[model samples]
Target chain A: MAGTNGTIISVNKVRKSYYRDTIEIPVLNNISINVPEGEFLALMGPSGSGKTTLLNLIAGIDRPDEGEVVVGGVNIAALSESELSKWRARHVGFVFQFYNLLPVLTAYENVELPLLLTNLSKKEKHEHVEFALKLVGLSDRMYNKPGQLSGGQEQRVAIARAVVTDPTILVADEPTGDLDKVSAAEIMELLDRLNKEYKKTIVMVTHDPRAAEKAHTVRHLEKGELT
Target chain B: MKIPLKYTFRNLQSRRLTTALTILGITLVVFVFAAVLMMAHGVEKTLVATGSEENILISRKASNGEISSIIDGETVNIILAMNQVARTPAGAPFATKDVATVINLPKTDYVGITNVTVRGVSPDAFALRPMVKIVEGRAFQWGAREIIIGNSIARRILNARVGGTIKIGGDQWTIVGRFDAEGCGFDSEIWGDVLQLTDALGRSNAFSTLTLKLRSPQEFDSFKEAFESDARLQQFVPKTERQFFEEQSETMALFIRVLGIFITVIFSAGAVIGAMITMYGAVANRTVEIGTLRALGFRRRSVLSAYLIESLMIALIGGIVGVVLASFLQFFSISTINFDSFAEIEFSFALSTGIIISSLMFAVVMGFVGGFLPAFRAARLNIVSALRAS
Candidate 1:
């Protein structure tokens, strides 16, 4: 961690559940964690461990049934649905396991999607997108669509999309889960560069211990509790 | 932030067949709607164009049409003597005693028989209607058994050419000329000398109606009041020529309008359902795309508006195509029976700016109604679950 040692994300007594008809299945129970700015923290858990659910709460994609999630000083759990969306745009950037880049959009356009929310002019937005794509070493593939790129290139493009707006934090769930060993190593190297060189705050959830080993700090969740 | 319009456009383009079929459905509905409106307007235009605002028509009381009305010589003389009646610069009253009757004629295409109006008019009738211009051959002589056919009638009926003779009431009346009446109901009639026609048809002592020009259009109400109040003429009804033609067109135009609306309502239901099905399919197919958009911080309203605009664009494309197709109808003329007179009248399809605007507006309404539920469903999708869906 290179930046100021200040808390960027604070989770307190957060509880979450899922419903199957009339039955309530508990997912995350009273989870609490504090993530400092510029730290690359990895979350490792097996199946049905509530790892993705806890990541979603921290990213403002979902609200916990109990307690509060404060990211970048905003109480996201207390905000309205619309307010939560706007907060997420300015504060959190997400990378999914599926590399959720729209197939119809080119690499440049997919990275430019988050910048559309800003009041930047087209010229200015183009410059920002170019810089972000260059950071992921895919500057030459800017015009190529997601379908035309390999699995590793697609995940790199997704990373470029997440950081294009220079949000306060980046939350990625299973960023390298679908990649082969070589591609997974390359993705981890890029994530390491983002933390060490750019001082970006990243909280990633992963199933591969090799991928988690690259992070500065590793936390494990077992059966909805920290272990 | 909302997704750009190009995104929505490209999405529709991605599903070409569904988009095309939905558009075709709307096009059919709009085509039916615009064509019916044109039909009704054409009927009104043909009849209303036949009369001038400054003229008055005198007919027997309770008569529905000039063909069913009779005016005696005394009534014609009294109407001619009124001070409100205009006179020609040559000091003759601008009035004529006209005879109206229907004659059955064979269609040129051998499609069966149709009723054509035969009107007998005095010399003053030509001066009263300046729009009637002879396009071929010379005018008929005063005492000769000669007739002039209107251009439409000459074109539609067999043996109606200039210089041909047709047997009417056991007498061979020669066609002397063809005249154009500026696209009015008179364009479907044959004109001849009033005295000769009365003698041939054996209605020697009475005329069908008296048509006279008023000194000014403002004098019509006073003229009607005077004729109605006079005990000598109390058995007759006097109406402005415009009013009489309007009444003549009302029944036919209303019928066309009602029938057109009924058909349009039925077709629009099918079109709306088609649009709904297309939109619902779009939502179902693009669930992950929508979730990704929501994940990018686009509001629910933005997603809803994007889909609505897409549907509206489809409807507009269909509406434009329908209007273009309906416009070609203006080139062909159609004939139908005038309900009031029970006489055949010829008219061409007419298109107006109001009709185009209203048709497009109606298509938009259908699109909005069809796309609303599907768009709402898209907006209400749960981000977590939607992202997990393939």
Candidate 2:
């Protein structure tokens, strides 16, 4: 995984587990992978196959039990919790399976959330938020709450939030899992354009082969191991 | 970066019922806190206003109040002859011998009987206290069994109005007039000639206390010293009238304050628990939102502060409402027993700037205690677990 020159994310022998009542249940075991800059990669697996756990590791949302997870040339596993959060704010953007948009916020405010951590002035932040919403073709619905939007529109707003900060890597964990086929296809197309047009490095975890087909390369995970 | 303050406000608005119920609980606690403070302040104000700084009050050395003190006419004569005592325009010493006695009277509300103070005073009593005005009818005549009732007693006790008759021991005295004492404790007493009252109460040749007006307030120290150093007056103690009334209010005010704080502590505990439950429910419902915030690089402290601010806003609203409700109490006068004197005293609720500030601070403390654990729980939530919950 380290040999690649342009790799944006390098996973070296990563292992993760869940503990219940002091008993360990392994999720990801001895996994290694590399994602090059601007590459659209999808991780495919069945339920309980550890694909989501691996995605969380890559996104810096969770630490691995044992391994080095390097993203944008930084070993996130060695970073403290607060340091990892700062690193995530600067480098990684996430899109969740359920389109996790805060119901209290409108589309524009949801996208503006990540940029609040930046030192950008209010005028600059407004411009960035408007551009991100327009990119997702939801500029007209900028002020609409998540409840007021359709499923596809809500997913688009979540995507806008993911890319609003122009992060170094974008991680989507089953981004289309909760949408209908047409809405899911629209979301997949949006992710495709975000990759080819914006040259964003993307790591997507999905069980749908049609969603996987939109990515440049697809890797399979089975029984907590990469295959 | 921090979550915007509106986020906290909007979340509280989202759960209107829970927010309202929590605010209501806090409101009740604040109300009790402020109302009790007002009562204590009222008692102090009423008693403190009863005395003039320039006058001296003489009572038995160990007496708790004028009602329990006995000053014989010999001591009164000695006090009046002192050069420190002021002379009136007619060249008479501006002094009066007074007696205090508590008599049981039925309440105007038809409740059980309560004790009322009947004060015996000389003709010079009115000259010494210029604030006492006869508001209705004529003043009681000297050496007659006629009495002047204070405005408060006339309104609050049965058969205490002007022109009414009140039975004292075996004699019936006429209430010839109603006097207003300008909101002081004297407004709760009935006044008549000292000799007549002593005869009617079967306590002849003895006076409860002697009040003397000084030419200047600075004369108080010399006046007190003159009486204390006199071998004939050694059984009595003398103090500035202000000091005497202040001592009278001390025990009752302290009792009300301690009782109020005790009740407030108990009520605040329940209110804090109510706020805690409401905040916990908010955390449980917004698990994903919190995770999203954490994942967005807002620190755990930010999440904790957001919820804390939310709870503080609830308590603040309740405090305002409670203070507003307590202010209405100023319109009604209530009576309670003075523990030291064993007499009913009437006073209106008094709101002060200190009471307002302290009550609001108390509400904030309740919010802090209630919100702390829940906010910490929200802050320590595992990002992955929280995101996965919804």
Candidate 3:
């Protein structure tokens, strides 16, 4: 499936459904989207709008019933579970609203996690972790555990972890959903900076209008289709 | 850190109550395992370890222990001239004619007769077993009624210590001292002058056996050849020290070993089951965490390994604890009736490295057996369902 020269992710007429014994319920209705290099796209919808379903499909965490999902020049829809996992590790960085930092690990160790999948030496891993923490402006708090940090600071560490490997794209599912108003604003501002300063591609799913305002473009997901 | 070490610590730390309870269960199981092994060891150490390879007891044909054997004093002198006999400094063969008898002696705690062996010896008998030494008092007079008891007899029985009076059959004898042969089977015996016991019991012409020290273990064949070929005492048979003890322990050892296995198998089964429950609970408690690891790019094998490691640590802790506590059983002496001689013999616990290693290996196996299914369950988790669980 050839696309534009600079396209980073290509989804062609993706249709996904879930089976309940004898019945199949469609979640996405012939969805099609493309995110090129350095794009900042937002997926917006209210509750039950299939926004999360489409995000999961695009992220390669799940496959569409019948369609193509190509990211970073690889079709994840055709990959096996293990192959997809390796592909996700090297190509995709995911940030969840709960800021899923391993509670036992410090901020530094949390950001160092994804790099473990890489074959980097210990010294190289340390450099990558330090650089990622510094990028999120949390270098001073790297030794602090998630419980010791504020909600906003924990989210920043999550962002650092997502981008620690320098992947082609960052995907966030309601990145600011759990934070207070000020902390939510801080997280959105960090994502905007990641887009403009580092030329990072970001795909975000959000219910908050304020969060989507920071994205370069927004798509509304309703009833099984993106409008 | 590796996934196994990482999750093992996390699982133990996260469920403090369950972890402590599981460890306690394992400890109890291990304790029983160790205690039974100690009892079996005690029985063996009392008998087998006491015999010296170079010594032989010339008992009668078909006679087992000394209580069933008797040879005249004249026969003892005839066996001393054999070429394979070890010589004293004066070039006389290192041999002594003696009387060995088992008596009903009272223990400090048990009211029944604890069999205390009393050996009536000549002066040369001391040299025959150089390992024995008078630790508390002097040896008995050559013809006096004074007696000396072994260390274990003196410490474990009543009225048997140094300067105490003990009655054997109908005769009263004074315990002049306590002696030791390095806490071997000899430590539960009494020694007196042979002529006194012979004269008092009216068996003056008879002795239990002629004790001889051979030059080495290899000289047993020559020793047997010289003794058995003598036309004068054609029935006299020579036995190596180890062979003699082996004959004594043969029946009893098998009985004890079977008993040990029976007891251990019961406790080991309970322990293995207890470990299984704890490991399953561990998997149930950490299902979400396992799912999260799967979502984070860890392979199923790594997750399984992590759970197995955690179980092994717990089982190993319990096993080591059992062994340490079992070592203390060395101090406890048990009185078992020797069916061959019908005398209650005393035994002390003996620990061997084989027992410890076997116990540790058994614990590890229990960990592996108990932890498998749960680990498989953790590894097979669907990452989405698990992350969405709680």
Top candidate (lDDT): 2
Q: Pick the winner on DockQ between candidates 2 and 3.
A: 2
> Native-contact fraction for each model?
0.39, 0.69, 0.12
Tens-digit per-residue lDDT, A91-202, candidate 3: 7788888887777678998888888888999999999999999988999999998899999999999999999998878899899999999999999999999999999899
Candidate 2 clashes between residue pairs 3 or more apart in a chain or in different chains:
none
Best by DockQ: 2
Candidate 2 lDDT by residue in tens digits, B9-50: 988888999999999999999999999999999988888889
* Model 2 chain B worst lDDT run, 10 consecutive residues: B219-228
**Which of the numbered candidates is closest to the native, going by highest TM-score?**
2
Ranking of all predicted structures according to lDDT, beginning with the best and ending with the worst: 2, 1, 3
The CA lDDT at B128 in model 2 is: 78
DockQ of candidate 3 (2 decimals): 0.31
Error of 1 at A54 (Å): 1.5
Candidate 1 lDDT over residue span A62-152, tens digit each:
8899999888777889999998878877877888888998877789989999899888999999999999999999999999989899999
Q: How high is the lDDT of residue B163 in model 1?
A: 85
TM-score of each: 0.93, 0.96, 0.87
Model 3 residue B128 CA deviation in Å: 1.3
